[model samples]
Target: MTGYRRVLAHLREDVLGVLEPGDGLPPERELAIRFGVARMTVRRALDELATEGLIDRLVGVGTFVAYPKRNIHVQLTSYTEEMTRRGMIPTATVLDFGAVAASDHVARQLRLEPGDAVLRYRRLFYADGQPMSVDENFLVPQHVPGMAKASPPPSLYRYLSEEYGLVIDWGEDTIEATSATPSLARLLTIDARDPLLKIERRAYVGRVIVDFSVSYYRADRYRLSVPLQRPRRAQQHRPVLRGR
Candidate 1:
């Protein structure tokens, strides 16, 4: 291992792990002298620790230990369902719900003309009493009867299957890392430059598009994971597409 790595290992094992939150680490010069390494090596080690969230650095102050972040595995279920399965009390607060004039991009996604009607659903998803994500879903008005004036449903997928007989046959989703916007930061109670997970999805029932949703998930409290395995001989010959 490099001198920096050795120093990092020592700090992680013998120091940082045992330190309480807000406990400050030694200055870089002090660590360098103690470890018999260059000051640059100690600085690099501390930089990595800060990136991993095991330490927090305040300019003009010092570097201190911090609480570890929580990681939530991704799954193929509604927020309500997944949080419930994890034994967390999930709540969806409707921020805005009603029919709205559609934009050209929104209309195209729902297979409607630019001026066509669309029902907009905006909600804040909370789990274990903490805000986790904000989602905005735009749906084709005719597909969901009376949704234009109704309160936002707690579990939209459940409502569709049970009340409207529409189940999402398939969906296209894209996820990426982005910094929080001013509005999003305010709602999620995070800094504007904090990292976030952006999810854009379009759900369909057979050939008809149902809804297009864009969501921002708090990265500190969430993680995206996918299951993978060696391809089976038979499956490799005839791959079966799956969704998660």
Candidate 2:
């Protein structure tokens, strides 16, 4: 076996096997010395490990075991439910809450007039005590009256279902890639211009639009998992030939 391959196998099996996620690995020179390989070989091995998602190489910061990315399945469940299903504690902090005049875009989504009052709120969500995402939501005031005055609920879906009987029947989501701004960087504890997964959703209770929300998720920590199914082909009718 070649030197780098041997070093890669040894590091993958012996070194990383004992280390927990976020645990730092030895420097390249130390690894090279320990494995009796060239420093270039050690770097190559580490690069392969990083490509396989087993480790993270940060500039100026040494390499460390990478945390497994959480899969966010495309479903109707709320963030609280999703985190709980993944065996992580979920918590939320309400950053801002107030009634505001709906903008043209938000009003169109919520089926309200542009100048109509809407409850606007911002929330920071955490999973296992780590900040996961930030959500900004606009709701029609008539549907969720007094929500601004009341303490924010742990789960908005649960609150809507139980208190107001406004269960979300369906939702449409538009997803895009975005970069974190300075303000968002502070809230999410990430560097400015870091990649983020942006999801804008319009949720409906029957035919009535209940909520329109925009969520920004750290791309490194979360990934989308969507299940796809092939559509059935339509039957083709051929012209029947009579007696020729």
Candidate 3:
């Protein structure tokens, strides 16, 4: 990275640590002199930070720290399902809904033929009126025909399980870090460059693949945990005997 960016990062971290909620930061000239950089560099850094919602920059005054992001728990379930299980009312606003030709990645994930049409649904989910996540899902139209016409329920899994008699027996998913896109950032009300958790999940009903979903979770809100177990000594290996 550039020296300016490096200094900016350090100052950003320091400011975050020292700043109380709503506390303003030092003046730009002071910051530049403190870091031995040009005032323009400090201004650029501050602009980046402000755009990310980490700080609120006032014109005549200095910048102030904003409230910390919310903490959201992520599980092996859909946003609506998980929130419902927690006794929270889950709501969804459909962002994009239509059929489209499967991309190579989506085709591979859903086991679809190249150029085959797939039903795509994108929705922003909320819990108790607060934005929780955005889910972009792709599925074979034959498997869930007329899904769009179906009474847009809160949970898709429940619809499949109850109405269609398709029980989700198992699923596999991968999670990684990503930056929100401009559209996604606007929907989630965060900065586009904000770090986020991206989950790619392929759900199965018995042995049949049902749906493939790519979900973007706000990093400040979501943390995923997986439990691991140690193998038993007997299962692991046999100890070598040494003659004394």
* Cα lDDT listed for each candidate: 0.78, 0.82, 0.74
Tell me the tens digit of each residue's lDDT in model 1 across 1-244.
8898899999887545577755788888999999999999999988998787778777888888864444444444777667777788888788898888899988877778998889888888888778888999898878988877666677787788788998776777677999999999999888897889998778878778888988888877776765556877766331121111
The best-first sequence of candidates by TM-score reads 2, 1, 3
TM-score between candidate 1 and the true structure: 0.72
Stretches > 4 Å off in candidate 1: 1-44, 48-75, 228-244
Strongest candidate by lDDT: 2
Tens-digit lDDT track for model 3 on 125-156?
77777676788888788888788676555566
- Supply candidate 3's per-residue lDDT for 115: 86
The predicted structure with the larger TM-score, 2 or 3, is 2
Candidate 3: 10-residue stretch with minimal lDDT: 235-244
Model 2 per-residue lDDT tens digits across residues 1-244: 9998899998898545788877899999899889898999999999999898888898898998876779877766777777888899988899988998989999888888898999987899888888888998888888987888998776777788899998776777788999999999999998999899998888877667788998899987888887666555796322111000
Highest TM-score model number: 2
Report the error of model 2 at residue 75, Å. Answer: 1.5
In candidate 1, which residue pairs clash?
A: none
How far is 178's C-alpha from truth in model 3 (Å)?
Answer: 0.5
**Off by more than 4 A, model 2:** 13-17, 59-62, 113-115, 232-244
Q: Where does candidate 2 clash, by residue pair? A: none
> Between candidates 1 and 3, which one is better according to lDDT?
1
